[model samples]
Target chain A: MSNYSKVSEFKDGVKKGIPIGVGYLAVSFTFGIWAVEGGIPLPLVVFISLSNLTSAGQFAGTGLMLGLASYFEIGLSVFVINIRYMLMSLSLSQKLDRSTKVGQKLLFGYGITDEVFAIASTREREVTAHYMYGLILTPVIGWTLGTFMGAAVGIILPERLQVAMGIGLYAMFIAIIVPPAKHSLAILCTILISVGIMCLIKYVPFIKIGEGFALIIATVAASAVMAALAPIKDREGDAHE
Target chain B: MNKEMYYFVAAVVMALVSYIPRALPITLFTKQIRSRFIRSFLYYVPYAVLGGLTFPGIFYCTDSFWTALVGTLVALIVAFFEKSLVIVAAAAVLSVFLSGLFL
Candidate 1:
């Protein structure tokens, strides 16, 4: 690609990323306060945000840490929480431009959060390395910056307000799944099945499961059931749309 | 290990587990997946996971059950309109804060 086009694609990617960055600021800010409130040090909280760049994984992992759970539990919970990214990565890999190098793929692969994958995969044109980099950078900055600010200043916030902000991340999750769920019965069934399974696990006294394991069970069971019941015939065209 | 050392190690492990899933697939798999079941499974994973993560947990996020419920309803209403993430999230937080005052 020409230098001008590469730069423009990069700029366009940044433009698309701005909203995601803004959204991340709110969610990660909540994460930061929650993590610190859980007894994590300020610096470590920031470091976690910088390295993980994921809301659910970071929250679960750090919560496990604060509880003094075994390292094995921490690793397993985080991996389970984040395993969805692999499917996203696989789907996005098919959308990348043919000329994208292996090195570029490796580097940009690290940047494929849920929001990034959603925007990149929905694009009309094939995704490029430059565009992915631009898209990734803004959110990373916003996530890290938000974490730092929240951890540093969160203690000063009123108790009620802090508690209220706890709903932000879940609200974001609702926003994400609800739109897609509204569009397709299959998706709605899949989500309902997942929630149903989760409720059973949580409420049923005989079935004792950890939160991480519960999530895995719900996700796998729901997806498998829906996939079997309503398999998508047109993988390429119908999958993305 | 000491407490600080333990936390650091945990962070490293979490980071590794997080990165491997993301980096492994895109870097290693270039070909389209052929299995219809797997493709469909992958397609539904996001919704299922997000759904599982959000509910039950969302109800307990705020101080009171009533506030959380109010916030959840507001979120559902805003998101039903296909509002942006920030707006939906902010609406929930604001609703919770406002409801906390009354109840």
Candidate 2:
């Protein structure tokens, strides 16, 4: 800990943000293209990316623009998909510096994407505002910039490349969960449980539901079941891959 | 173009709706919680929810299920070794892109 100056820590935070940001860029680029291809204007796509920051929420919210969903439906969808963030933020809240100001915390609150929370919460030291800001800065740039570029070029890109880029979003999802799931039975079970539940709801005619509602149910149910059955000892220590 | 108020309004609403859940935890986390059980539960939420988000959806993201499967296999292999996120994601993308040529 002696070598860890505030500046070096800040640099480390920025470094961690880079891969997350790059992954975000590709995922959001796919969003921008999809939204635009779905008939949303470039400006609105960029606005949503700039303001929304997260992936699933924005994609769920775009239903409003497509006439396939009502405004109320879009709002409800965004909330359900984004509800996980509250838990992430709650867990992260426990990890924040004790002396951190409310206003700084408020600003810091918005940047708690899954990857950011994953990195921040696993750290042994309390996360400071300086470190948080450094961690956030690049992803903010990457997300909005990717949105702009994707929207600008979405129409012009060849069909092959556009379809190829769609894989990037799921690829990012795989990268996030596979490492931890590989090491832990609880994690592997959680994936199977949630995915199995989702599959039943998706393919079975009697139990089908809206995408947002299905996600909320799957996530909450899986988390509750696992938390009860396979509680990780707080002092068992965090896992990093 | 002039009548898009509803979309913009929806975006603002989504932003606020999303912000509360994220920000509220700050007040909760700063104070000492009385219950040890609930604290431990919150620790696992990210993992479970991340799993919920990952599978089935990953397999169905592409037009061809075969392409997606190949991509998932490639990614899982890379991620199993604890490769960086960028490498894992790129591996999935490239594997899918390659498989698309044949399948």
Candidate RMSDs in order:
3.9, 3.6
Work out the TM-score per prediction: 0.79, 0.83
The collision pairs in model 2 are: none
Which candidate wins on TM-score? 2
Q: Write the per-residue lDDT of candidate 2 for residues B1-103, one digit (tens) a residue.
A: 3435766777777787677777777655686444545655665666666666666777887778898889888888888888877788778878888788899
Once superposed on the true structure, which residue ranges of model 1 sit more than 4 Å away at CA? A1-20, A23-45, A55-81, A91-99, A113-131, A151-156, A239-241, B1-10
How far in Å is the alpha carbon of B18 misplaced in model 1? 2.2
lDDT by residue (tens digit), candidate 1, A1-241: 4233788889989987886787677557777888888888888889899999888788888989999999999998899878778767876776677677888888878778877876676566778899999999889998998898889997334778777777876887887878888888898999999999999999999998877678778988998999899998864644533
The Cα local distance difference test for each model comes to 0.83, 0.73
What TM-score is obtained for chain B in each of the predicted models? 0.80, 0.83
lDDT of 2 at A139: 88
Q: What total of clashing residue pairs does each candidate reach? A: 0, 0
